[model samples]
Target: MRPIWVWLKGPLPAVPWPHSESRPDVDLTPEHVVVVGASLAGLRAVEAARRLGFPGRLTLVGDEEHLPYDRPPLSKEYLGDLPGVAPMLATAEDLRELDVELLLGAPAEALDLTARSLLIGGESVAYDRLLIATGATPRRLPGSEGLSGVCTLRGLSDAIRIRAAFDAGARVVVIGAGFIGSELASSARARGLDVTIVEALTTPLVRAVGAGAGAALSALHERNGTELLCGVGVEGLEQQRGAVTGVRLADGRLLPADLVIVGIGVVPATGWLAGSGLELENGIVVDETLRATADVWAAGDVARWMSPDFETLLRLEHWTNAAEMGAHAMKNLLDPEAAEPYRHIPYFWSDWYGHRIQFAGVPTGEPEVVTGSWTSDEFAALYHDGDRVVGALTLDRRGDIMKYRAMIGRRTSRREALAFAASRRQPIVAAAG
Candidate 1:
């Protein structure tokens, strides 16, 4: 078998070998490994465990009746004119080959850490090892419950319903200008529907990418013929005959709409985990190795684990982070004695107005445009906290963003980042638009 090298903080160990194949030097395999949440992360965890030669019983439990499916496209292509079935992460045959038991439809009701069991559908399932990857649920608009033409996109069923509204040529009002909301607005406009975005912040994505970059990104809406209302709060939903008719603004204006997509945010799915004796802050508080407690682990959006590299706690809700965390957490679970800290630089990409926007690392300090001009709509910006490059954002510079991502991981200095940008042979703008 090919050797797997583990990266440590300092110099490499003398005997460099696959940690999974070499560590512990004793049997640590569990009889039954039960994973809660059959989404991307949970599924990946099961696959990873089997690949690491754990010939044990594995079970995947999910609240949704359908098998695990990809979610990124739910707000993009899935809502477009030619909507296709939600893409599955694993097929029935795939799971069969993995030799795993599957439980669908019933959500995990509670977790009994002391008893080492999970309660699902009024039944207790015992397990020697447990992994929680329950993911998250979308936050809803206040007073919009039970109203027709109101929706929040989080799953396949939500996408199918929203797609029907778009097909009917509904005038859409998207609340919040975050990634999900922005993507929904983009798809609405692509379908030739009148779209308007309402953002409470003065600038959209200000919290995620800072003011200047957020403003630059918000401009894409206007350029694509969509109206973007910023610095405005939603008072409530205007309804007629139990159907949403418009959104009343705090400033005494009502934006007429036939459909309203609430993309405010999502909270971690921890209600079922209440009193589970696990530390639950914004998410399930896990250590650097994603261990919540002895014999228990958490991953994906539900996990708020410490980042050894950044020296802080982070809970990421992105496709790449979820997929990576699943495999890492499982490997760590299998080899508890030799578990390693998960040092990852957050990365995500989005499609808007025919432009692919990608960002890596945590956005900190002022953004310095290093390549191309914002006017050209092809640029890369570096973010620095003191002398260390902490983050990078790019608009239509796909090939160059990963280079900056690597730099962020290495904690590249500002001078070094600038020099690398200069080597690109492209004019570097001094300020981001």
Candidate 2:
């Protein structure tokens, strides 16, 4: 069967799609840009707009009270309770210098795409260009809501609470073996806490890195003293007087726990645009230019746009994609005449138990070829769909990954990738350069 992405492929929208074309009354000035979701993507949108010479009313709205901060650290150093590991990306002075009107702690209640206005805090804010960077929220397990001692780490506050649990030496039961759950387990194990990770899949990160690499990661955690319960589904949460105490598994085993963290994944924050006439699927569907509707654009995890390079629509949740997509969305918003389709090679990295795992490109299909040993702490795996190098993953081999990143970017043939991978030549730097 063809891949889902192939099935979803369609013709790219013609240049100057509706609401993307220039209008006489439309204010193309900087101050007219309204960015929702005060996240890494949202903050970058405002900054990129300014850099693109958008000089007008620039307003940023966010549901969280805290200013934009780094989220990836929340699972690593922040979870370990390391001092001075602030995730703040921009300071108050920085926003002021950028002339960004930041409206923190105000959630967007409704969106008027036709009127090009956003309703927040009982006020309608008009905008010539609206960028939705609301990102995503952590998926919660059923019956876990309203229960104390249960947390989903998505924000700074969530990380703090989980850190406190770790500080208390709480027995942690993570409900997914994905990136977040695995990283949290690593942190909990580092603090000498009894950690257990339950994954419905056969291995960790099978979706991102494939079963082979995922199994290697699963073993990595097991070597670090984390209990691995793979291929088991959680039936429900066991609670004691409104507080979580344990997790009930599908096979009738009850895993006792002091704290439970659900890392099942996340859904895009597109609920506010429900009746606003924007097409919604896993995310807000946009054209090749990332325009959701007339005068409205979206970026980050919340916006799913057609990938001209990959030949399918993609909504990436990684930090790198969010920042790049935000800048691209804003640039197109400022200049629709010169608007270019969003084409990017997706990339992301995660730190787990003293190992840095980085991946570039899509990593689609099976693990067709590998450059080095997977059991080793340092190696790189090159994934291919037939003769085309689609993606690559590296374990502590940053330099090697960059080479494969370029190969995938150039759409190198499988023969070339294999030759590069199998070559016993020294100094890959010269060959790659």
Candidate 3:
């Protein structure tokens, strides 16, 4: 596979990468801090701000009518008809205890950076400090709209709707083989429904995990009876009476489907910040301290902050990153004078067909050394940038992910990591024939 560093480059070349964690000494505690976006990141920011004893008016503004809810389960447990409870991030009592004023269903129409105010629900809400944790919106395939049974699994409502259709024995066709699509396929297979995943890449999760691990995941999915159509592009959606029936491939092939899930990916939810004059590329460009501007800060999927660890600007969309960044964003908002760079060892996990896949660090570059067999069900592959172990991917190997995560933090050498992984006592478990 080609290097991922190359792909991360060349996007918005004008914005320079932050090289140092230095900012002017400006100490002013605001009486009110408005956190836009009421999702996981937004909720965590408010919680952290309150926990840190920020004796200010904390307001959370959300576009969705429902309160902040967990999103990761939307593709897993919540995709089934077993228990359809909306997993909330913060309940009424929790919000009350935290003393957070929640303005749900009020989407910020515009951000007045100069005036330090947000236009929400036709009223200008001024803030001493502003946090843009608006997150991101899923990208939909062109012409996929106006068709029934077409869904994007980004919100709680979308999961419920898809679960109901799947329970009714609808043939599932997922448009992307990313984590969401793969997880949804696994969930659909659990319901004994016909599931097919179409991916443009040669292997599943090629971008996140390396080629070897991605191939292992692809094999696992196929073994579990999930048909994977990789290295193919979807041309259009076939509709019958305003309902999607199937997907037409670029190669002039049709795959029948009763319900179509578009998990292609997401774009940063920064469209509302347009004309506000904040640096906007793929996301709100932030400094190492997660500061978008002098007083404006962003977190979660909306803010692309320079990573001191990786020495690159990263906009991580995983749940863990969102939680960690949310907490750090609040801390920085309270004390931007500290200029503590948000340096973190990125980590995320996924479950597919009963196998737990965990990865840490930037899983880019080439996999030069392997601990166990890649073809095996349980093994760990170490990726390296030259001699430095840059990242790691583990399948069904619990507890070992942390070891590699720390190793990446320490910048362990390739030889040391390979020897350490090879010295593990667990015997290699072969893939079931």
Candidate 4:
């Protein structure tokens, strides 16, 4: 049986069929550039290809029928107060003016690395250049398919479902305390609904933003009447007649829920490229230049690029990171040898319960930490690797964080930073960095 979503396949106005796929007759010169994914990274990639003077066929392939739009609002503004904000790609009327074809809703069914062509919908689309901006999918518990009232928020439909559940005041149980989960909980609370957030980790956001930030976030959720179950693991989901009713913890606790939000985080949406010969550990592994392998590049939350300093692959789902990485990936796709390497002080911003929090740099493996607060709602917490500052987290006071982000551009000393924190205006310190 054909899926109900098959009607979702087609090309939009300027967003025509994604060219630059592995098709014959496409010039190797700057004549054809195909970009996959129509959302944040894919959209930006097309623009970058244009900027690189690629004066030829531009094709964009996306998995979603809806043109690219913002995801940050899904859990906050879109669900809480605002109603008319829908997902949309950037106003590329300029690209429309340039005759770039956009292929919407048809995902790459298979990737032929040897052929350098993607068999999208069983048709071989050739390309002089290709950009894989596939993006990420929500990480969910195993065996969750066909569970009614259970969903993960990563795309338009997910947001629509979760948002509908919130408006209905469904008894919501969210798994994971990561950024997405926290935002969902806070948004649900704002709508005056019963929401419970279940976290498997000890501290929320500590894995990504560190402990102090996590503690503050937990406190905020508690103060706002959201129940947070820490140190709890969801072993399995309970269903009554194929409909989700509750969540079962590994410790033998049954958490009843009319609706459950799983924010366990996201996995790179790279499953389509299984045999594409790309080095994919968890995602499409790319280099510093955002180049995956020969004639291939990836970006956004799906691309796991090697970190400059750290010996690890960093796949940040931050908004700023997505924009930065997408731009860089596009540049490389045009001219692999002439493109600049990708490196940005990773930053993420989230708003919840009237608090605007911003963070820069990856807060990982901190031995000792020093924090500074401000009279204004702006303050920065510094994460340290021994005596060197590696990461910083900020709250309401974003300007100070802006400055700190600039200061810690390459690296900084912990002692000097701590001095600034101690003698400064609003100082708040938590020794656990």
Model number with the top TM-score: 1
Candidate 4 local accuracy as lDDT?
0.74
Per-model TM-score versus the true fold: 0.92, 0.90, 0.91, 0.86
Ranking by TM-score: 1, 3, 2, 4
Instruction: Write out the backbone clash pairs for model 1.
Output: none
Instruction: Judge candidate 3 against the unseen true structure and give its global Cα lDDT, from 0 to 1.
Output: 0.83
Candidate 2: the clashing residue pairs are 30-54, 30-55, 30-56, 31-56, 31-57, 31-58, 32-57
lDDT assessment of candidate 1: 0.87
lDDT string for model 1 (1-433, tens) is: 1111111122222332355355557667678898898899999998898777777678888887777899998888887777466888988777877777887778889899999998887778899989999999999998998999999998888888899999999999999999999999999999999999999999899888988888888889999999999999999998889999999999999999999999999999999999989999999999999999997999999999999878889999999999999999999987788789987999999999789999999988668888875556777888888999989999988888899899998989999999998886343343342
Per-residue lDDT of candidate 4, residues 187-257 (tens digit): 88888888888898878776776666677657778778998889878889889998898999989999888
The clash numbers for all candidates, in the given order, read 0, 7, 0, 20
Question: Measured by C-alpha RMSD in angstroms, how accurate is candidate 3?
Answer: 9.1
Worst ten in a row by lDDT for model 3: 1-10
Cα deviation of 374 in candidate 2 (Å)?
A: 2.8
Model 2 reaches what TM-score against the true structure? 0.90
Poorly placed runs, candidate 1 (over 4 Å):
1-27, 425-433
Candidate 1 vs candidate 2: the TM-score winner is: 1
Residues 289-395 of candidate 2 have per-residue lDDT tens digits of: 99987688999999999988778889899999899999999989887666899878888888889889888888687675355466765667778877889898877
